[model samples]
Target: MPSIRCCSSFALAAALAAPGLAAACSTCGCSLNSDWSSQGYATSLGWHLSLREDYFNQSQLRSGADSVSRSSFAYPADEEVQRKTINRNTLLGADYSFSRYWGLSLQLPYMDRHHQTIAEGDTGVSTSDARGIGDLRVLARYQGFSDDAGIGLQFGLKLPTGRFKQDFVSGPQAGELLDRGLQLGTGTTDALLGVYKFGYLTDSIGYFGQAMAQIALDAREHFRPGNSLNLNLGLRYLDAGRFTPQIQLNLHGEQRESGAQADRPNSGAVLAYLSPGIGVRITRRLDAFAFVQLPVYQHVNGLQLEPRRLWSLGLQYRL
Candidate 1:
């Protein structure tokens, strides 16, 4: 028979794990994928704030890792130049739950980017750097499902708050404009819809699944980004002392960008990642989490730079 303290600890673990923990995704583009972050944690009326950072460095032009079979254009053997990019992001997000049934979340991010394009014949590299605030996202959530399980719907808007037309200031392309896709923001308003579900597989383990769709409501500067969808499925262990271990499978797909300024050939892809993470409960109202997403499968429409791996780290506090 289990002791009373052990039983109580189990109950506490279950109670804490029943609600979704809050954490941001690393690959939602400029939009906020906050649906999974609010689950299992916002069961009551409370305010939550989180600070997260993620990094990605893309130096290789891959058509799925060294194979250019799917690319529409092939590089000549003499062509020695391609593109490389390094992106860093810092995000601050806040959430307020009016009750167990209603909540709102807002996120703002600062983006730092460095892009380099090598010349075809020369070994010279041209570099352009841009740093500024990115887009903003606001989401309203409604959780009208049974208390024992979690199911919810989210509707939101993405505001264009960053710079879309960034010019190369000190490179070979100086005075020339960068690709619209490489800009800090889309300069278009977007609509977001999402669904999430959370439940227990057993007494000591839990699972969550979420899907989100983002579409541009309007175009800007004759450029319109493509529609995107993100799906995540994860499992977590509840009774692991102060450390919760989790694994997630994430699938992200996008339609190609369209417009006169769009680079359709290098715009869209469907990628699958295996993300493993750990959650630490620092206190009753504070928590920390980190995740690393590794690409298991990738299919790009054209030649593009894709990161070998991505990582996210964050801290959350409830008030």
Candidate 2:
């Protein structure tokens, strides 16, 4: 039998804060179970490292669960017109288990994002690209609830280690500071808490469930991201020997942005996705996985850009 650890991706913060310059859904992330997201969790107690890369493009305009045209947000008539947003995110994680009861994990994020938008009066498209480290998270886990450590709790802190003062370098918005939601970091410390449980329904069927919350501690320069929450459920076919086939349902919700610089009319959202993935063990110490996410339901507070699909690939090695 394989051990299904309760590990998840982190980005759980607030949405954009600006005069409608940034993107929406700060809660949008890879959302992978990712103990490596693969099968290399190493049931033993030791150090492990994992890396995963994800890509998504938000070119579709949506409002209140309905698709809208870009012309609906034209200049003068509206304060903003969004063009497109693209993201390629990479995550590095390290985990160490002290015993069956306790463990520690650290995660770091790097982002390559491009945004294009037009202000209310500006006719030209203003573009900006941000590439750098986003944030760092440190967490502790306790899985001593059962003899097999199938139930666990996770608590952590999101550090403000990334740059939030980047500026657009092209078009009419050149030299203007990038919106809070598009920057490399949120610029605010956040608290994270979550719980998870994993077990087997039968000898070949395994199931897991998790819920997490991320709340901002304070605002920075009159801008703050909203609080976010996530819920996940998954099942894996364990009969495949070296290969594990999996399916998951993920739910994400975020509050509206707050602060004078923030506009609530175009931010927060509630999104649900269906994710299916497969994992393969290449060696005893190495594993790989791939997954794709498609939105089953999406409702936003206001005008926002959302991806039609998201995909990711990952690798993990036990050291």
Candidate 3:
């Protein structure tokens, strides 16, 4: 058996490192691995590494003109404008376990953003592309309670380490509109709380679930800081003492508080997604998995940005 002191020490380390791993969640977003494992415990010192990529295409804007005619003069009364944008995200990270109940993880990410506008005469303006590293995150998980009862608690923190500049822009003209719209970091701290549970349905099949929430501490002008909640359910099949196939579904929502900035309005947003994932075990000491995130509903600040279609792929190695 591992010494109690050793386990406690590892737990402390994981808790302290939680902030770094939490930052990674900003780009990758929260995942289903609330405690870093479905079992809530590690058999030995272990490491997990993963990579992910994401792409986004925004909707096009439309405009029309209004005209008024009088006996003396005729003039256009109104004009319209629209914009389009694209974004990409790349994430990389790794984690280490000191014992079955304790572990630490960290992640870093890079982001690219592009914007453009088209006018009525087939004329267009292309904004420069902006690329740079995003925020960083650290995470820690401890199986506070485990065994026949099948329950545990995991805590996490997020730190702001990414670059933040008010004047930085993709085009020659820089302003708050662009800075706030294309923010790379929230410039604030965030905290997470989660609960985990698992059970067996049969000798070869098992089930796991988790509930998580996050709170952000800083608020940007016209942007209200907010909280998010996530719930996950998974089914796992064990075989040959080597490979396990797993499938999972997740539901999530977020609420934002109103802000004071007059130029920007504060509004709430909600999102729901259904994802299917699979895990493969290469050996007793190594495992990998991949999944796609597809949105079912999304409302941003009372505006609908796009149709519910997005996907993410990731691979993990355990050592």
Candidate 4:
């Protein structure tokens, strides 16, 4: 029993699926499309709930696509020299939908993070602050081919529960640790795959697309983490009054990191973003959303640290 125009564009496209600072590179963390938009549209059924938030700040310093300066990262630059990272992300979702195809979903994340770095010749400037929970996803979907289901397919897992050997509580690497791509969890276990589609080109417009992947599976202590992909494409505007407007383009990529506590050349990247949003219904079951993700292309693979804009907000319910 899903209506209100199919969960209002998946609760405003999950506000671009924030997902916290999923590791600073290696394709980076979440770019949206968590379990098919996280809150709705698995093609009608039952149960639903969602909550999301995502913020970003990564202080410039690029490489593959230019922008790199910060006193050459340090002295005689042998690398190492990151300065700033502040991300806040919280996501919580739950869904059922055992009909119209199939469905099951769960996502929970939390991360506060803060960091600063400088080393390779040392010049002070080393810090860290960690927060709780991260990593934990579970998904499943299928959209009976036709029957107005609009196509779908997804699968998931990504559990490692969160918290992985964190360290560096303050200053000059106080207590060391930190950096397995910026901990908070990456302790292995990962696998997810995806596909999605939506329709309608008129009648008030509608569109959607998705792709996902994560990989990993095992490798901890000696580090592994790397392997990612995310893609989203959206458009929505259906009016029946109650506001609704959307836009999206998102994209992501990754592949790097390996044994020996990797950092394999600053991980990996190939980002892109452009989200824009609005959504509200607040009735017939509730809904609300917001987004703004700007990046429009980045390249990374060396220096790292990026983030010029990113913001998200969300809420959804139907139970």
Candidate 5:
């Protein structure tokens, strides 16, 4: 028989392993195919504030049915399922130029997420909202090589701070939602390594790209934070002397695996979108911009998350 402390540890590990099971066990995991930061270097203060609105129409699942399989307390019959989510985020930080060989960067972000599900013919709907500061990241960039044409190198980091608890809806999956949203930290540390490069195609045109992979340490049991990979590609139109107006597109994806021997699921998720954005130079020390993200494709564990589409408007200032 296991000791009391050992039993408690086992129980805790099982509980922690549940969330990833949903992603890992089914086709839904296919959606977790890439990392989240595939946008290259196109944000504002070098700071950026983005407000996004997302709408999703989920597939209907069967509820309680009547005798003879007639019509009873079924879910909304309408095929149109709707959910609205709002996210407001601010990234404040800067990149330092430490000669042509080394550099450093720091960033902190504040996030607020609100979700609502609306069903046809139903007067009462369900809602969940959370607001708080999210994780903080510190990074160092090395300028391994550069010419008048472009610069390239590797980067790495530390992520601290976790989100806080917030209200959740009541339902069968309420616990899952609450756990995903309010569990604060993953109770683990993450390390990432990435390569970035930027250069000009011409005096008036520029391009950038980056790739990164991360591994988790001290992860919760059954919830092995799988290795993640991200890629970014973008093009910009530079002003001869002033700030430039940039119209660019970004792509991102991620994958997560369950811990070994854990009865949990393992899976992947991928999100790919195109964003048209614009940036303006306000002064020698300031710039601002806005963009919209439209999901061209998204697959979660082999199932579709409805129509994966979102709109984002943002602004940034640099000093």
Candidate 6:
């Protein structure tokens, strides 16, 4: 039987922060599980490495789960517009165990993104593309509960390593600075806090729950990303030998951005996704996993482009 583990982090933190800040659309964040911490095979003092890739294409504009096909302009009196976006992320993560009760983790990501918009008033298409490294995250974790009923606490920081003020090299919006949300990074330092718990049921099934919070501590370029909260509830069936099937419910909510460059009207949202995944134990020291997230419900604040679906694939190896 496969071992049940509790591991999750902000693999998509940069993606979710981009909507309205940089692009005319919103992108889904891919929260990946960190299995090395809980699996019995990784109880010894050592280090673990992981590689993850996430993909999503968001093109449709919506308001509260309802599509917004066309909107009449109040000022122009005869204009309508449409927007779309695509984003991809590749992440490298590392975790080290200092003792049974303590550990540390870091994540670095690279991103490629495209944005496009068409308006009735303008015949030309407005498009932009950006590719580079995203932000960086470092976290410290403490496992303070019993072996059976485990509880973990995490605290971390997000560094502004990704480019924030990218300009359109060529396009209808050429030489113009992209939206702060559309940049590779927020150019802000953020504080991350999280708590998680896991346990088994009937020796064959297991369950876990986690909650994470992100708050921007400082801003750059007259812009600041919004504060956000994330919640995840998951069930793992461990009786399937080397193959483990899992299901997760993920919920995310964010407050609107604040500052001079903020896009208040098109910011903020509450989104819930149903994620189905499977894990394969390739060896005692390596594992592979994949997951797909489908939006079950969404209540966006304004007319913003939202993701139709999100997918991720990853590998973890003990080092």
Can you write out model 1's per-residue Cα lDDT over 8-81, one digit (the tens) per residue?
A: 21111110000000001113242223233334565557787778787777654665345442234344323424
Q: lDDT of all the models against the reference?
A: 0.64, 0.71, 0.48, 0.71, 0.39, 0.69
TM-score of each: 0.84, 0.90, 0.69, 0.35, 0.64, 0.87
After best superposition, candidate 3 residue 117: deviation in angstroms?
Answer: 6.7
Better of 4 and 6 by TM-score: 6
What CA RMSD would you report for each candidate? Answer: 6.7, 4.4, 8.8, 14.7, 13.8, 4.0
Q: Which stretches of candidate 2 lie over 4 Å from their true place?
A: 1-22, 25-28, 36-43
TM-score pick, better of 2 and 4: 2
True-structure lDDT of candidate 6: 0.69
Instruction: Return the number of clashes found in candidate 3.
Output: 11
Clashing pairs in 1: 19-40, 19-41, 20-39, 20-40, 20-41, 22-37
Across 95-160, the per-residue lDDT of candidate 6 in tens digits comes to: 888877788878888988887765335555667788999888888777757663267777888889
- Superior candidate under TM-score, 2 versus 3: 2
Q: Judged by lDDT relative to the true structure, which candidate is superior, 3 or 6?
A: 6
Cα deviation of 186, candidate 1, in Å: 0.4
Worst 10 residues of 6 by lDDT: 8-17
Please give the range of 10 consecutive residues that has the lowest summed lDDT in model 5. Answer: 9-18
lDDT of 5 by residue, 11-103 (tens): 000000011222211111111111111222321113322222222222222111111121333565342122344444444444554544455
Cα RMSD of predicted structure 1 = 6.7
- Candidate 2 lDDT by residue in tens digits, 1-319: 2444222121111111111123553344565557521122333588878788989898887888988887555455456667788889998888887876677788888889888888667988888999999778887777776677767777888888889899988989899987777788878888888787776788787777777788888888898778878788888777777777888887887888888767667878888889988877777677788889899998887777888998988887777
Candidate 4, run of 10 with poorest lDDT: 14-23
Task: Encode model 3's per-residue lDDT on 243-295: one tens digit a residue.
Answer: 44556666655554434421122223444556665555555444455556576
Which portions of model 6 miss their true places by more than 4 Å? 1-23, 32-43, 70-82, 119-121, 147-149
Candidate 4 runs further than 4 Å off: 6-30, 34-37, 45-59, 62-69, 72-75, 81-101, 104-138, 141-155, 158-217, 220-222, 226-243, 246-259, 264-291, 294-304, 310-319
Taking all chains together, the TM-score of candidate 4 against the true structure is 0.35
